[model samples]
Target chain A: MTLRIYIPCDAAAVSVGADEVADAIRTEISKRKLDATIVRNGTRGMLWLEPLVEIEEAGKRIGFGPIGIEDVPSLFETAAHPKALGDIAEIPYFKSQQRVTFARCGITDPLSVHDYEKLGGLAGLKKAIALTSADIVKMVTDSGLRGRGGAGFPTGIKWNTVAGTTAAQKYIVCNADEGDSGTFADRMLMEGDPFLLIEGMAIAGLAVGATKGFIYIRSEYPHAFAQMNRAIEIAYTKKILGANVLGSGKTFDLETRLGAGAYICGEETSLLESLEGRRGQVRAKPPLPALQGLFGKPTVINNVLSFAAVPTILAEGSAYYQEFGIGRSRGTMPIQLAGNIKQGGLIERAFGFSLKEIIEVYGGGTYTGRPVRAVQVGGPLGAYWPTHLFDTPFGYEEFAAKGGMIGHGGIVVFDDSVDLARQARFAMEFCAIESCGKCTPCRIGSTRGMETIDKIIKGEDVANNIELVRDLSEVMRDGSLCALGGLTPMPVLSALDHFPEDFTPAHQAAAE
Target chain B: MSQLPRKPTQKTEAGAYDLELVREIAASMKGLDGPLIPILHALNDRFGYVDDTAIPVVANVLNLSRAEVHGVVSFYHDFRHEPAKRHVLKICRAEACQSMGAEKLFAEVAAALGDSAQVTLEPVYCLGNCALSPSAMIDGKLYGRVSKEKALAEVRK
Candidate 1:
C-alpha cells in the first residue's frame, strides 16, 4: 500500500512556508525510494501547528508540525519526531470544535467532487432538488439560520422575499469578500472546501428560482480566488453545475468575480454596485437587495458560511441544526482567534462560549506571556472589551446587549502594554481611509474625530477635545448610511469608557 | 489568475500603452456582465498599471464617460495610477496585525525599503490570513510570523 501523506495548501499555511516543507517531503521520499503519495489538503484549523504534515497510519492520520524544511529528514529517520502530534482529530483544539460547516475542510481534497460527495456534499442540493422553492425557504427558516456577514438578518426571510418576487432573471450572489481584520473563516471555507460553497450557491439558486450565481471574492485572496475559479470550472465541466446540477435536470451555474481593494464593497449594496462596474458607493435601503438587486432584479445574497450551512441543514434537517446553539443564534460560529495570542487560529463552537474561555483556553493565552489587556470582538468597527467583560457570551443578542457585536465572529486580543487612546485613533483613521464617501457624516466625522484624538494626545485643551469626540461619534453613529459609519463609535466610545487612564493626560491628572 | 502586476507588453499611442490594443481588450470584455471593472483589470494586468491614455479608449468601447472609468480605477486601492515598482509589498495594517506589533514592523520596513525603487510599499487592511498575524505579501506571495529581519530579507531579494 502506498503511504498517504497530507499537507495543507491553505494560504495561511503557505504564508508560513508549507510549500517549502512539501518540497522537502517530496525529496526525502524520492531519495529514500519509499512508496508514498502526497495529497495537498486544506487546513485543519490547528493553525498554530500549520504546515501540519499528516501520515496515514492504520486508518488514523497522525499529525506533526508547525514543521520546517529542517525537520523533514528526521521524519523518515525515526517514528518519534519531537513535534509529533499523535492523531490529527484527537488534538484537544481539533476535538473541542463542533465542526459543522467546516466538517470536511481539512479531510478531503478540496476540488475533488468525489471526495465532496462521499463526505456529504451535494446531499443538501440533492435534497433541495426534490422540494419546492417554498418548502426550501421554510426549511431554512425553521433552522434559524442568519446571515453570517456581521449583520444578523435571517437568511430564510431574505430568501423568502426574493422567492416572493417574480423576476425574469433572478440571481444568487455569495459575499466571499471577507474583509474583516481578524476573520478568515470564509477564506478558509472557500479555499478548503470550495465545493461546499458551490453546493450552497446551487441550493440557493434552486430555492430562489435563479439560474446564475456569482461569488465576489477580494483581490487580496488570490489563492482562494484561484481555487474557487478552478473549482467552479471543474463543477461546470462535470455536469454538477449548469443544465443538470447533479443530473436533477435543473440548472445552476456559478462564477467567481474578483473585487478591487475597497472595504466598502464588502457592503452588499456597494458590492452590487461594484459588481455593476461602478465605484463602490452605498445605496439607501427601501428596496432591499432581495427585491431590487443585481441588474435591478431579485437577488439572494448570503455570506459564505451562511450558504455553506445549507448543505448540512438540508441533509440533516432543520431540527438537527437548530438544536446546536443558544436562543435565536442557532448553529456554530467559526470564531477566529488572532493577534498577540499563542494558539491563534479558527475555533468553531456553539453560541455560548465566553470570550474568556476562547482567549485563554483554546487560544492558550497571550503569545507575549503578558496579561491580555483588551479583546476586540468583531472587526475594525467592534467594541474594545476590557477584561471585566470577558464573561460576555458569543451570541448575537448577547454581544449586542453588552454594547459589543459578534460581527463576523473575529476576536483580536491585545496585551497590557497597548495604549487604548492609540487604538481609538486608529479606529477613526481606518474609518476615514475606507469610508465610501457617499455620506458626509462618515467622511467628515472620521477626519474630525482623528484630529480631536490627536489634540487629546498632545494634552492641549484635552477635556473639550475628548467631549468633542463623543459628540462627533454620536453624530456619525446616527447619520451615516451603513455600518461603516454607524458602528465607528463603538470602538471610540468603548475605549474611552473602559480605559480612561489611557486617555487621561498625566499632568492634568496630577494637578487634579 | 494572477492578481499582481505583469511586464508591460506592446507599447501604445502616447508612448504609454497601445490604444488600439486597449480598445480591443475593452471590446472583448464588453460582452461580460459588469464588464468595465474586468476591462480595467485587463489593462492593468497587461501594463502592470492602468495607463491614463487607455481610459478614453476603454470608455469609448464601453460607451461610458472617461470620468466614470477613472472614478472606478482611482477609488480602489489596488489600481495604481502609474506602474508599480518591480516588486509590490503590502503589509497588513488592520487591527489583528496591529495587535501583533505590525506597526513596528511597518515602521522598520518603511525606514529601510521606503525609498527603494525596486519595491513599492503599500498598506492593506486585511489579507484574511489573520491567524498568522503580522502578515505581509510581496509579489503576490504571502509571508507570516514575519519579523523585521524576515521581511527585510524577503524584500531585499
Candidate 2:
C-alpha cells in the first residue's frame, strides 16, 4: 500500500514555503519510486511547524516538520528508517496546544468533503438540523462560546435575542472585515476551511430564524474572497446551502459582499453600512443590530471566528468544549503570534495559558533574537504589556483585569529597540486615519490625541500634554460611538503608563 | 481681491452618468445614515474615483453636497482621486514590521529605487501579515518577511 502524507497549502503555510516543501516531497518520492500519497492540509496553528508534513499508516497520523524544501530528500530517506521521523506527539509545541476549534485543521484536506466528513466536519450541522431552533440556541448557550470579535459577548444571548424578535425580514451577517493589524485567523479559516464557516452560518440562520446571511469580507483578502465565493457555489451545488439544505425543508441563503479596505468596517454597524452600499460608519447602540440592522430588520451579527466555532461546539457537545478553558472563558482561542518574533504563527490554546509562555517559549523571543521589552496583546486596539506583566493569563477576564483584552487573540511582540512613544503616536494616527467620522470622539479625538502625543514627544510641556492624553483617552473611551474610538486609547495609554521614560523629552534628547 | 478662480462649473446630463446605477447603489444604501466611505468606494469601483461627471448623480441619489462627496472621496487612503497604477507597492511601517528590521529594509528599498521613503516610495502601515514579519503589499497581494532581494523581484515582476 502507498503511504499517504498531507501538508498545508494555505496561504499562511505557503508564505512560509509549504509549497516548496510539498514539491520537494513529490520529487523525493518519485526519485525513490516510493509508493506514497501526499495530501495538503490546512495549518495546525503551530505555525512554527510550517511545511509541516503528516503521514498516515496503520490507523495513525504522524507529523514532522518546520521542514523546508531543502530537507525533503533527507526526510524521505529518513522516513524509510525504523525510527520513522520522531513521533509528532512528542513535539512540545504540538503536545501543549488544546486544539478544539482547530482540531482537524492540519489533519484533513481543506476542500475535500470526504476528508471533512471522516474528520467530523458537518456532523454538527447534521445534528443541528435534527434539533429545534430553540434547542440549537440552547446548545450553543450551554457550550459557553463567546464572540471572538473582541467584544466577548455570549453567542447564545445574541442568538436568543435575534431568534425571539419577530420581523418581516431578518439577517445573519458574518463580519469578515478583519482589518486588525495583527490578525489573520479569519482569513486563514475562510481560505483553508471555508465550508465550516458556511455550515456555522447556516446553523446560525436556523437558530436565529433568519433566512438570509451575508458575509462582509474585506477586499484586501482577494484570495480568501475568491475561495469563499467558490466554496459557496460548491455548497449550493451540493445542496449544502440555499433552500431546503440537506433536505431538511428549511430555506437559508448566503452571499458574500466585499468591503473596499476600510478598517472601521470591522465594526458590526459599520460593516452593516458597507454591506448596504454606503460608507462604513459606526451607529449608536441600544437599538442594537440584533433589533434593527441591515435594511431595518433584526440581524444577528457575529465575527467569522465566532460563527466558525459554532460547528465545533455542536459536533463535540457543549460540555466537551466548555471543559477546555478556565473561569468565564471556555473553548480554545486561535491566538495569532506575530511581529518581531522567532516562532511567529497561530497558537490555539485554552484560556489559562500565561502570556509569558506564548511570548518567551512559543515565540522563542524576538526575531532579532534580542531581549523582548514589550508585547501588545490583542490587535492594535489592545494594550501594550511591559515585560513585568507577562505573567498575566490569556483568558478574556484575566486580560481585562490586567487592563488588556484578548482582542481577537492577536499578540504583537516587540523588542527592546522599539520606542513606546512612537508606538503610542502610531495608534492615534491609525485611529485618525481610519475613523468613520460619524462621531465626535473618534473623528476629532484621534487627531487631537495624536497632536498631544506629538507635543509630549517633542518635550513641549511634557507633563501637561501627558495629562491631556490621559484625559482625551478617557473621553474617547466613555463618549465614543464604537470600539474604534473607545479601544484606540488602550495601546496609547498602556504604552504611556508602562514606559513613561520613553515619552520624556530629556530622555529622547539624551538618547539622540 | 481676485476671487479664487470661481472653481469651474460642472456639466450634467441625463443618462450620461448612469443615474439608474447610482440610484440602485444608493437605494441599496438607504438606511445607513452618513454612509460617505461606502458610497465613495462604490462610486469609485463603478465609475473610477468620483469624477466631476459622476458627482451630480452621486449627490442627487445619496442626498449629499458635491463637496461632501468630494471630501469623502479624498479622505480615505483606499480611495484615490485618480485611477490607480497597474501596480501599487505598499511597504509595511507598523510596529511589528519596524521591529523586524523593516527600517533597514525600507532604506534598502528606497536606495534600490533611488527615491525617498516619504515621496516616491509608497509606504503603508500594517497589512495584517504581522506573524510573517516585514510584510509588503505588491499590486494588492501581500508578501511577508520581505527582504531587499524579494522586494526587488516582486516590484520588478
Query: Best candidate per TM-score, number?
Result: 1
**DockQ for every prediction shown:** 0.54, 0.21
Error of 1 at B26 (Å): 1.3
> A1-512 in candidate 2: lDDT tens per residue?
98998888666667667877888888888888999988877776666566677777676767777777766666666656432445665567767887767666666677777777787878898888999999999989998999999999999999999999999889999999887767888987887788899999999988988988888878677667777777787788778887888888887888776666678888999888776655677788879999999988999999998998899888878888888888999988998888888888777888888889988788888878889999887788999999888887778899899899998988888888888898899899989988999899999999999999888888899989999999999999999999999999999989988999899988778756
Structural RMSD, model 2 = 7.2
Task: Tell me model 1's lDDT, rounded to 2 decimals.
Answer: 0.89
| CA displacement after TM-score superposition, residue A240 of candidate 1 (Å) | 1.8
Q: Give the Å error, residue A48, model 1.
A: 1.1
Off by over 4 Å in 2: A2-5, A19-38, A53-90, B1-76, B114-121
Q: What's the true lDDT of residue A61 in model 2?
A: 69
Docking quality (DockQ) of candidate 1? 0.54
Task: Give lDDT for model 2.
Answer: 0.79
TM-score of chain A of each: 0.98, 0.94
